[model samples]
Target: MKDFQPQNEEVKAIRVLLHGPVGAGKSSFINSVNSVLQMRMTNEALASSTTSDQSFTIKYQTYKIKKEGKENIYPFVFNDVMGLEEKTGVKEEDIKLALKGHVKDGYKFNPVSSLSDGDHGYNSSPSISDRVHVLVCIYDANASEMKEPVLQKMKKIREAASELEKLYYPS
Candidate 1:
């Protein structure tokens, strides 16, 4: 949302994390949203041009919409993560770490390992602004069906988010 103000002073903007299968248009969606906000076609986040199964995005990146006027940036921000593949893409553990705001921006996705507390990219004490306010799982309608392993990975990520919700909004 443009020019939106949060009721809580601690929150500067809402962070949204977008994740999905490889070539599922995660980056494309970000570009589209930015294009609409800037009123021009621009591809700040590079979308996959190749047909390979590997993910085009390999690092965590945050995208902010900047307007020309006084209200420079929108109150909503987006974080694009590496696409998930059945077996060789982003690991579920890394995604879980990201949801909890442990993974920092520009941190390269290892795929083989998750970010530990001691890692430089790991944020041990993430503030409200650093935490992900929304988790968006993009599903490709063009696909025949979601693979079993990828679906399972997404399920685990969803569970992690749910558990994080408990920590943030405990009853």
Candidate 2:
């Protein structure tokens, strides 16, 4: 992978966005990727296997995976969003804005509210580096089916992502 270089030098890293239902192992996936890249078991990102229905992640976070004993950062960045819930969860509008690079990192996501134009965390314009280059929708294999609301939200998100010409991967 080290030999692989981005076609656009203006963008330092390829941003990957991960979206899925609550407790769908998004955080665990990030941790596992980081651990594998570093050749060690690491838990830099918080992950839980609890059965609680409440969402554990609350903010938009970008994680950088670095190889052990190296000062250079990886060419890829993984962005994690608040998990989606049946009744209340990450707003669909917010996800759309995020795909367009309007949502900034560290923005606290409110389940009851969507981001507004005047919000302090909102970025009117973001560079290509800040935009998501790839969108990944994670589904639990153990689950028989997804809730209607959650599925609708995912569909909308996929449409928005497609409009932005971002690579979409369902896993």
Candidate 3:
């Protein structure tokens, strides 16, 4: 598993976007995947061990896995974003923008507002390399069942992700 590369020549690597409700372990998952790939414990992606109501991550960050003892990186990468909350956290429109590759890395998220075409964080013409190859929603297995509003919001995200995927990979 250490020596991994994408079969498609057009794709340099797969970018998996990770998002979920606040405190769902999205960042931790990125670190975990990184650790597995490096064969060592790594906490490069900061995460709050304690539970909290708000998101610990505020900016959009992409994580690349390095192949141990090799100069090249793995054929897959992980993208971590601010978590979703019912009334706060990352805005839905922001996720949509990210799915379409409009959101650039290091852009701080505004729970109240989404990025527009003119925003510095917005990429008007995102290339295929900037787009997400996969959408991963991390769920907290030990948490209680989600409320209706949050569930509805997640459902909407799923639908939007599907639409974006179709836009990228037409069948």
Candidate 4:
């Protein structure tokens, strides 16, 4: 396995996707992270708005973080994708578009579009790696019956990423 290191001083931004099951409080978590960091989301590029039943539909939210003393702005992109098990209205394409940026009908999402080559149509670009740095996979800590579903989803995510790495960069 490759030893992972923190980004260099020149590398200013980081892409993160907050994926998990429904009602696992992904959106709430995002709000809390911003609250702690003293930042607010300004540019909402994805489906952040939804009704009560299917509110968490968007794959993710791209946020621009401006750290103190940093010359370049850090892109704190967080993808709040649908639950893996019960995907009601969510589409795989939406997931692809959220992380790597997408381009459709003259509209351009550079990040999503860059990730269109992977098995799940994600970015395979080295410069802009489309893998989740920190996948905040949430599960109901209290629920008993439904706990397994959430856990299974998290396992699938890990397995998928691991399998992908093994396929592309096998030892």
**Winning candidate number (lDDT):** 1
Candidate structures ordered by lDDT, highest first: 1, 3, 2, 4
TM-score of decoy 3: 0.93
Q: What is the C-alpha lDDT of each candidate?
A: 0.89, 0.84, 0.86, 0.47
Writing each residue's lDDT as its tens digit, candidate 1 over 1-102 gives: 564777778888888999999999999999999999889998999998875689999999999888777878888889999989887889999988888788
The residue-by-residue lDDT of candidate 2 on 47-85, one tens digit each, is 776845777888889999874445477889888888888
For each candidate, what TM-score against the reference?
A: 0.95, 0.91, 0.93, 0.56
Query: How many clashes in candidate 1?
Result: 0
Q: How much is the lDDT of residue 23 in candidate 2?
A: 87
What's the lDDT for residue 145 in model 3? 89
lDDT for model 3, please.
0.86
For model 3, the superposed segments whose C-alpha errors exceed 4 Å read 69-71
| Candidate 1: clashing pairs of residues | none
Model 4, span 1-171: residue lDDT tens: 022234654333455666655555666665665555545653333334442434344433445444455444435545555544443433334443443333121222222223345444343443434444444566557644665644554666566656655654589
Q: How would the candidate models be sorted by TM-score, starting from the highest?
A: 1, 3, 2, 4
Candidate 1 positional error at 94, Å:
0.9
| Sliding window of 10 residues with minimal summed lDDT for model 4 | 103-112
